[model samples]
Target: MLSEPEVAKHCAALLEHFADYCEQMDEATRGYVVRLAWELIGDQMDRPSVRRTRRGH
Candidate 1:
């Protein structure tokens, strides 16, 4: 398994990539991407942090 810091770094990159991919799509496609992202984010909002602990939560 990756160390906590390493996993966080990778997830950050992936989130960036997801945003970039959405931006590059046509308006119709972008809507789908945005909706999917929102769904995933909403599903996790109340869950404990999956990333490393820091000075702030």
Candidate 2:
């Protein structure tokens, strides 16, 4: 399995790339992209995190 720090580094790089791509999108497209990303992230969250997200924490 990947080490935790390695995973974090890769995630950071991915976020950078995603941010750049999103910057090129129009407001509506960017909103959709963000919402889709949120849903995908929610799917991976543990129960407590999911609850906090649902509560808008």
Candidate with maximal lDDT: 2
TM-scores across all candidates? 0.43, 0.43
- Encode model 2's per-residue lDDT on 1-57: one tens digit a residue: 224777757766766777889878899988776665565444433446455434555
Positional deviation of residue 10's Cα in model 1 after best superposition, in angstroms? 6.2
Candidate 1 structure lDDT: 0.62
Alpha carbon lDDT of each predicted model: 0.62, 0.64
Candidate 2: which stretches are off by over 4 Å? 1-16, 43-57
RMSD of each: 9.3, 5.7
RMSD of 1: 9.3
The best candidate by TM-score is 1
Q: Candidate 1 on 1-57: residue-level lDDT in tens?
A: 234777757756766887878767899987676555555445432345654334965
Worst 10 residues of 2 by lDDT: 40-49
